[model samples]
Target: MKISNETKVGALAIVGITLLILGFNFLKGNKLFSKSLVIYGTYENIEGLTASNPVIINGFQVGTVGKIEPDPDMRRIQVTFNINEDIRIPNNSIAVIAPNPLNITKVEIKLGNASDYLKNKDTINTVASEGLLDDVMKKVDPVLYQVNKSLGTLDSLISNVNSVVDQKAKRNISDLLANLNQVTASMVQSAASLQSMLAAETGSIAKTMNNVSSITGNMASNNAKISHVISNLDSATGKLAELDLQKTLNTLEGTIKELQAMTAKMNSGNGSIGLLLNDPSLYRNLASTGNKLNLLLDDIRMNPKRYLSISVFGKKKTAEPLMLPQPDTLNAPYIIVDKKNN
Candidate 1:
């Protein structure tokens, strides 16, 4: 057949337009030759979700995202994904949007086991997966709030400190800081001095320590002597313990009582010793007798011729005995005399 050029050009244009439409739809993730199920999901926000994003089932590519747009109310984002018709999805399955390690967005259908399968254009439950960044942001939000609150508190504290610290108080604090520094310096100097002193005395200290060690060694070597002393002490203690101390104390108490009784008797003037100590009549009588004896001895020495009347020739014996002078009556010394001479 003879073909018109206009017809040929029009037919080429139609073929090109059809091919362009098919290519556009294929890029939009519409399966032209394969069967698929269209499912819908709604979210408050979809991050990085676009058409042609793969819909995965257990990490296997099942289909692709068909479209993503705000709903008619513009209040929610509606995502439409096409799943493979061969892959049965239960009516109760959930669709989740997640990110890959490379931060690529993906749609995963969590398959369910309900006997009734999901039909085409059915709405599935949607959940946004908590990615690393999302979790980090969630955790960082509270921390940031706490940090802000802490900063506010710190500001308030600084204001309070400023209000409390006047010029005098600041001066006092400065003085205290200076004094503390001086004390620290003094302590450092003292520590250095002590270190030098210890260094200088190290040999003496070692010698003293050696002497102490030698003394301890000698004590250890003479342990038998120490034991002997301890044994002697123990034996003495045993002997002292065996002694009748109570009986001895009782005897001593009895002796003390007797002495006390004797003292009481003496004090009461009941004994001869007490009478000798307390009475004066016997002493006066002894003093008077001694005086009289002394007088008689003096009289006899002076008047011996009067006291001794003696005859030279033999006189005739008289019947009466010659009388001697009585010392108390005559108050003179007595002497033997011859009767004829008298």
Candidate 2:
């Protein structure tokens, strides 16, 4: 039993065609031999979605999209996707059209907490995830709007400035600039003057510096004398600090209090000295007594024989006592005689 060449060729062609079909279907995400569960979902829009896009569960590929068509109501799109039969899907699970890193759209199944699994051909909830570009636009929209608003504001500000800054303001600004330039030039001149004044040998500043150096040198030469003086001052201060100033002050205070008391007593005319100072009658009496004493002294000097006998020649003549005071004269001695005798 031998096959003909034509039959062999036909068989080979059939086999090749079969392999090619299988390969194309495999590349299109069709599982030829495995059992798969088909599920349905409806979306308002399925812009990047197409058949053969992978269906994922927790980032693992479970199946692929099967078909997409407008619903019977012609209002929304209905998507058919297949998942492995072994991978159970809760009835409340969601199918989201998500973009991968490559920007390829896929069906990402988010499992729900329902205990009941979804049966074949059951509709799952579908959501269209915002693409990267959509998200970027969403975020950038506000920024662009703010930028435009700011530009508008800036333009308004520029217009207002243009209106407010007239020729007079420009002239003022130019005058301010000129003044600033003059001030700058003055500062430069001052700086140059200061530099010249700080010359090493010829400037007044140099002379002052030399004087200061000389003074410092003199001070350095007399440093030992200064130290000695400082030491003496320190010693004096220490001794002064060691003195019993409080006790001295207390003693002085006591003396001052006593003096004050004495002064108060004198002022009050309470003591003998106070009485003598205050009584005019006593003063008058003392003056009278002094005058009488002076007359008695003059009488004694004028008549010494009356008071004492000089010789033993006869009985000493008894001298009469002065009873009146005589008027004082420049040529005669001043005397006071008793009035009765005068």
Best by lDDT: 2
- Tens digits of per-residue lDDT for model 2, 206-317: 7789999999999999999999999999999999999999999999999999999999888888878888888756656666676677667778877878767677677765
lDDT for each residue of candidate 1 in 1-342, tens digit (9 for 90 to 100): 999999999999999999999998788667889888888999876767888888988989899988788978877999988888887888888988887668669988898888998889899999877776878899999999999999999999999999999999999999999999999999999999999999999999999999999999999999999999999999999999999999999999999999999998888877787876676665455555655665555566555544575657865343332233335545643333332433
* lDDT per model vs. reference: 0.82, 0.85
The superposed Cα distance between candidate 2 and the true structure at residue 214, in angstroms, equals: 2.2
C-alpha positional error of residue 12 in candidate 2 after TM-score superposition, expressed in Å: 46
Q: Cα-based RMSD of the predictions, in order?
A: 22.7, 15.6
Scored against the true structure, residue 269 in model 1 reaches a CA lDDT of 76
Which residue pairs collide, candidate 2?
323-337, 323-338, 323-339, 324-336, 324-337, 324-338, 325-336, 325-337
